[model samples]
Target: MFVSRLLAMCFLCVLAAGGTVAWKQRNVTIDDKHGDEVTGIAPKYLPSHAWSSGPRDGLNAKPNASLAYNGTWHDSTHWVNNDQIIVNFGFTGVSVYVYCIIANTPPGPFFDAFANYHILLDGVFVGEYRHDVEMIPDYFYNVPVYVNTTMQNEFHNLSLVANSTERAVLLLFDYATYTVVEEDPVVASTSTDTAAPTSCSLLPTTDQPTGNSQTQIEVIVQVGAALGILAFFVLVGAVIFHLNKKSRTPVLPGTTLRHISRVPRHLATFYRKIVRSLTSHPGESGGVVGDKSSVAQVRSQNKD
Candidate 1:
């Protein structure tokens, strides 16, 4: 029984370690990331005009694409139909919301500038820009003159498509801006744990009194478990010690002289007195103490 109980305790310890490891793995998740535009990409980007680079055409985000050489910007410098304004936005595969800015020279027709172009996300047509034409060429306001992709989830390469087939009708790259949308961790991350609350996990580690109380309770349980293990080990040790002591004693079985010889030395005198009294006559002795069978047996065994 002692050996079995010891083995069971060792098994429980192994199970405990395994359970801890599993718990750590279950609740762990990579954090969600959120931020703005080309900052997330490497090398930022440089404008790669599909047709030809007009002098002073710098591709950059926001007010950065603020100016071009002549009269701020003129007459289709980066023609949407003929040119692919390659904005090498750094990273890919994550969700992001992109806003494309289209600008025109002062006095240019506010609505006419948006008449003939569409935008592509990695080569697929998401929508057209002329849908929301801004009506003021007032120099600084780069309005969403096209598809306002407020929540387009993912994109790597942004391309602009135009309506003109043979002749390059005008439209320019006003610079595009994108912001990373914080996305929840992948579904696979949440599958193993169903977000259940367990009492054992309520151990507090901070300033809240409730948490502290829970932590105290957990500590007590751990201490109690430790003490129980110690007690079990002590009990098993005592049993083994008793069995060993019994094996070492030279006591023989049933009615043997060795059994009588093995009696404690302190009891030997008393035993001798009893034997002498039994053998003596009842008149000479103080009394006859044993039953008849016992007396007969003792006399027979005396070999006298």
Candidate 2:
């Protein structure tokens, strides 16, 4: 039974590996379009704002707007194709403004609708906008739009397309500015076994004063040393107290008597015999008679 289970597990692992390989081999395709011309795309009478060749032609196309007149124009029949603007530089997002100068006309039909316009990036359709503007006669209109795209590649192609036939002369293209957006890198924080310092202040992040601050390891070592020193002093005090108490206590009377009894028997006997002889023979020989005579003579002299 165990062998069979092991074989089944191995087969499942092989199937999973094959599935992963197949998924990696799959490819995705993106659809794109190009622009070809910018002829009189801007009216001859209006001032030139900004213009670039469409994708249909290479870099050989000329700037369509004439900078001669400071005035700009916008009409229902005029339109400009920006399909040829190359965005070889890398970017994550962009903002474009199409400035229009219109004559006396109240909110006349113009390129204010975003649905009629869209932006492309790297041959991929990215975004579209529809804005509205009601202009008074002889006033200028500034139309701005924004598009966001991914920066998957270094070089990219961008184009603006007008879905409506409405014409509007572009005075200036405020320059295309790009912002680089990147995902913050993932950093997996790991814990270490090393001891970190403990802060004494309410705020843990605040720096400690230079003197007398304790690190974690130092605190532990100091506490251990203090306990050891206290224990040593306590032991020393106990020994001294024991010696003092022993010295103050008197020796037992019974123990002193026992020690005296253990003295040499001959020396004790000899001391007793000498004491007896002195008491028995008080005044005994010729020296005793001579002493008595001298005593009598001294008494007679004192009387006289």
Candidate 3:
């Protein structure tokens, strides 16, 4: 039992360590204008001239102070074809997020306009996002169009493609964010010429997601599970120990000389008197001087 309790405490300590690890990881953002980190290509059916990139405020619109890093974004304007603008990026993390400038209830012929985009993770369709007409605000900058929190901590591919045919559709991408687990820094005795790449762009070919992030709920659940397993083992061990200790004590099957020796002297004497009275013949009320049958029977039983 003591050993089990000690193990349970150790298990709890491990869970605390896991929670600390989860908390240490932080989100890293990658801007859409990072040409080397992200790839933006239009469908072959569409001409290259349709693609454009510039400052978000260049359209005589003010930048939302609380949103959009650097006020720079990528978009395609005045395209009517079904060709989609696909954005591809590679990151090393457990979760991914895509931010874009989406419009809802815009003026002109697009008052009820809506846009759709298909999200693919690692070449497989994960989900789709639809910026419906009923969505709040006229424009949403730096809004998360896609979020995927459940993923393994490794190098992964993410793709976002415009899927709508509406002329009012807006795929104004601003940035992308993902989470990576933090690794403990290794200290070397001497410095080297090579250094680690700090950006997600370098992750695809040169580096891996050594540091990853986790959701609060996932961390809580992991800790809870560890504690549950600890409790179960502790209870089982305690019960088994108790039973084993109890089994070691001998239990007599019937009354024997050893058992009588364990009893008090007064109790043993009283018990012997009762036995003698029961064995005495009914004809003999007084002390037996010579009763052959009774004496022989009692003596034989005592000898046995």
Candidate 4:
């Protein structure tokens, strides 16, 4: 039994060591030029009355070498004092990154040039960033302003807000990119016999479980089943060992057999001897003695 338990523990350890599954990853980019046109993920700007309708010309507007995602971006006219751009997107991956542009500035020690911004995910504040003039000298296009790598793989609400309104700090929102974990396609089993087709709804898949959650569930079920099987085998082994040991044991004797062996044994015999006058006594129909004592008396009488 002890050996069986040890074997079971080793088996469980092996399963735990090799239970991990490798998942693939990819990146999905959403450009700011077509924000409103996109389905289900349009960026909604707070206080809609303060923004412009089209991209207006600005100082050194174009990137150095077509660096912006898809050669398009939203200028600083889109957002101003305390304005927030909110987006609700679905992902099945690890990280999310926010990109923007910094327009060219004149030679001066203006404190407004150093802008401050805040990022929030799922209505919780994650972090913030400040644009420094010494670090970023000239007009920098398509740069990462805010990045968050610690988000669960699910549908989330992201908010990008301007924290500083000093002299209307320039904020060029270009695009955003999120890391996506691509799942391997499941191969369908085919049969020769024909079957009826199934129906599926053409609705959004935001409510469905992602690959990460599904994989985790599968692993849990598999481990539970394995443990159950191990327990069953261990119980069976213990029962068999008990039965074998009982069969090989010796049984003790009872009191009735001992009493029968203790009973005594006696001997029986016949004597045919007579004295000198016994011949005549025989003719007179002599009676025989009933026990050994009479025989002894007769012998004594003959002797007298």
Using TM-score, rank the candidates from best to worst. Answer: 3, 4, 2, 1
Expressed as tens digits, the lDDT of each residue in 1-304 for candidate 1 is 4356446656755554344322111111111121233343322222432322222444221123335322132123234344433333323333333333354332232223333555566666776555323555433334454333344445466555555543333444333344444434322222346642222222224655454456666899999999999999999999999999999986333344345567886665445545555555655643465647555655565554
| Model with the higher TM-score, candidate 1 or 3 | 3
Each prediction's Cα lDDT score?
Answer: 0.43, 0.38, 0.62, 0.56
- Please provide, for model 3 over 1-304, each residue's C-alpha lDDT reduced to its tens digit, 9 standing for 90 to 100: 4356446656755554443322346677777665324333221212345455655444422335356665677665433575667777788788988888766654344223456778889999989888676655557777888998999999988887765656545566777888888765433222245543222231223244223222444677999999999999999999999999999966543344456668897566544544455555656662454557655655565555
lDDT string, candidate 4, 184-237, tens digits = 543222333543222232221557744554566689899999999999999999
Error at 299, model 4, angstroms: 70
Best by lDDT: 3
RMSD of each: 17.8, 19.8, 18.6, 17.3
Model 2, span 199-246: residue lDDT tens? 123222335532323354477799999999999999999999999999
Query: TM per model?
Result: 0.31, 0.34, 0.46, 0.45
- Candidate 2 residue-wise lDDT at 165: 42
TM accuracy, model 1 = 0.31
Worst 10 residues of 1 by lDDT: 23-32
Off by over 4 Å in 4: 1-22, 36-40, 52-55, 58-65, 77-92, 104-113, 134-137, 165-167, 186-304
Query: How do all the candidates rank in terms of lDDT, highest first?
Result: 3, 4, 1, 2
> Which candidate, 1 or 2, would have the higher lDDT against the true structure?
1
Judged by lDDT against the true structure, how good is candidate 2? 0.38
